[model samples]
Target: MSFTFFTPGPAQLYPTFEKHLQTFVSEQLGSISHRSQQYRDLHKFTVDQLRTLLNVPDSHAILFLGSASEAWERILFSCVELESFHLVNGSFSKKFYDCSNALNKYAHLFEKPMGESFVASEIVVPEYAELICTTHNETSSGVQMPVAEIHKLKQRNPGKFIAVDMVSSAPYPELDYSLIDTAFFSVQKAFGLPAGLGVWIVSEKCLQKAESIRNQYSIGAHNDLPTLWKNALNNETPATPNVMGIYLLGKIAEDFNKIGVQTLRKETEHKASLIYKFIEKQPGFSTFVKEKANRSQTVVVTNTEMPSADIIKHIKAKGMVVGSGYGKYKATQLRIANFPATSVEDVEKLIHELGSL
Candidate 1:
């Protein structure tokens, strides 16, 4: 039986994943050395594809790392010298705040309830905080901050650096990269690929800031922004990287490119609207995020009348898996991802089965 995963993050597999893997092994992409010209070509190809796909600027350096969590650590340690302000909305966003604190920076926050988003105009950032962090999508709660709100934040605080966590929301609701200093995501979610790869896009300003403080303290060995920036200029990493993930991502990105981000965005909106409509009509379930505008276009979280696990089991029995609630809502909420790889037909089928239950 084929299982379709609706759970967020490492959710569904890209439709072309199998063919790409077979070719990956046949082409021996894994065996190539990091320093080889072949590896450089692969790296450059992926970077170029991502820059075009994500509308990334030439001023930014694209680096592949371990995970989004690692990117969180690097961003805080490298970009901020003393303090960083965070717009915390859920578990993942809070973690970024905690990460900066763990590194001994004075991290301030304007925290909101889960499934709630911030009012960008109402936020007051401290003058001392060097970086302002915001999660573009709170995967755990399915709350999405609008692009206009982020632009407002950037406009209000021109001097402060902005870092956005687009973990589950990238490749849709396209961002104007000029407003933010950096953004990062793991391919496991939106890209519909296997895990273990995190893409970090950092602007030139981040590189200069890190270099200025490089002698003051060490953020990390090779993964530091300065090193990642220096090495990426040559289409390389400071260490042996995820060659396979990079290749798969580039190929998958090419597929998204062919389809176009605007088309994917429309498809995402359509699928998400269907799921939300079903939630409203269904007696046993309700959309988690109260305000429709704050609801995430990528990760759709619903509150079930019965325990979420039972609902998950009910869905799983049919060879379909939906995510259980995250953190405190574990038994009461379920997360569903409407990523690029999940087709409209598949989503309609899933909705049909869900309605029957």
Candidate 2:
């Protein structure tokens, strides 16, 4: 009995990436010098792949952070000034808003239910607000925002910086990055790797702003976006880069380049649909997020008629692993990750086990 289903991030890695990682380790990775050419080359490779795969604009500056949360801090401390607008619809979004307040930056929240979409109408575009943050896909709630609508907001408001948390949305398809100032993600969810890496894509406008204010502030160890960008272009990081993670990212990008992002996106959608269909068959189980269109293609969250603790125990005993819901939804909703490596057969097997339970 292999524990085979519904584990969350770090999602299962592709076999090819694992093989490449083994070779990388055996070769003895030297210390990743932040100023070294070899390290810089790895950074450049990653940025180029992201730009090509995600259909990102050439003007956007992609910077690698230690984690997605680091991107949040960097964006808050470096790019955002005065105040910002925070859109909260799930655990992650809510916490992100709180983080902005903790940093002493004023942030207005467009509060909504966990799985609800943030309609552009909710935005007031105040004069003082310089940045706007939203999560592209909420893994905890299994809800995805409409990327098109977000771009529409950007078009309507030219001055504000649009930052998106795309942690759960990457390694699938390219996002619409035209109007976004800072788009960030942790590689663990989409890339199926460990949690040491963060990808930050910045618009040219953001760079201009950072340069304008460069001399006014002291550069922190990891949060200095301007220095990070300069290093990134040379295939380096401001601090020590994640050597093994970057190596894995290079391998993953090569594989993605060969297969294509659109192709991968379709496969991911298929995986989500398969699991949703299986959950549909269960008598007392239903999707946590009510809207069909808003549900995530990467994570599928559902609620069962039984107690969540009991359900978790039963599922685990049956050699399957699933995530408990986040924050208030904990003990009520179950999260199932359907990223690339998750298969249709795996979904069917989990459903059968649940049916037996």
Candidate 3:
């Protein structure tokens, strides 16, 4: 039997979106100039549609980069001061902090214990830091921070800036931009598009911070804040953007707006719940994160009493591919993704097929 259930970064593309992407490329085939008016119009429409769909405030500035990873570095290199606090709950998050430390920035990590949740109680964020960064949904461990709680923390820490890596979290509802200064995500994951495109939901404060830093220090071409912001506001890029990828992403936002974020959130919750329930019933499997309240709606990480390699091979032979553990958890875990393109039927089919494994 033929099957498909891989849930890594590039999950699956929507059929309708695929057709739209083809038309986009055919129309803009020879368009080499991203600074052209056509490109600017497309870019402006994308940013505007995104802001409307994501409920971003008008008091903010948004940008697009080649990749979300680039956005991470840009936020750190341009906006962050000499020091910042990094909150680590999983491997990818830890890597982000390590990158910050490599830049000679003061990175104080608050790592949570394995199989447990990250509580903000032990994190002592310094008063004079440039920003506080966290991942809203951890792809490595399948844990999601309650952004409502993060917003509450922001309320308490009035002057400190907040940045979020919402790479896999933006498709669902919790994109509460009221408290966050910079929220960045790639288009490939939950956005259901190809890679090489990133969306940045940047706040006015982030722009101000970036501007101040550029004025004080001689910024490099790659990290030029003023040019990046101006180009982004004009719906163009300082460098050539992935025009094809971005055009499709704008259509995705349009589709999401038609259905609404709340509806998508509900759909994701139902799909994730199906898989989680199936895992709970299996003898050799259990969720990586014990607390259901903390489980991610997009990625679900599980622990197997059986050898994880055997489990992975078994599932792959059946045509369903899942993610392995990252960093220290490689041998002990399996991850499943249930994002926007992953339908309820797909979840049910995977659960049934896993039974044969």
TM-score of each: 0.98, 0.92, 0.93
Runs in model 2 deviating more than 4 A are 30-34, 214-221
The per-residue C-alpha lDDT of model 2 at residue 42 equals 68
Worst lDDT run of 10 residues, candidate 3, spans 114-123
lDDT of 3 by residue, 1-357 (tens): 645545658777654687777788788634757878888888777887788888888877778787788777777776676887778877778878987877777877778865555555545787667778888888888888877757766776768888888897786746667777888888878877777887777777777777788766543477356788777767778877778877788888888888898898899889888889988998878888888778888888888777677878887786677777766777778888887887787778778876666
Model 1, runs deviating above 4 Å: none
Give the runs in model 3 whose Cα sits over 4 Å from its true position. Answer: 1-3, 29-32, 218-220
lDDT of 2 at 55: 77
lDDT of candidate model 3 versus the reference: 0.77
Evaluate residue 167 in candidate 1 and report its C-alpha lDDT on the 0 to 100 scale: 91
lDDT of 2 by residue, 293-337 (tens): 788888888888887778889888877788888778888888888
Q: lDDT of each structure? A: 0.90, 0.77, 0.77
lDDT of 1 by residue, 149-228 (tens): 98889999999999999999988857788888999999999999999999999999988888887788677785888878
Candidate 2: deviation at residue 150, Å?
A: 1.4
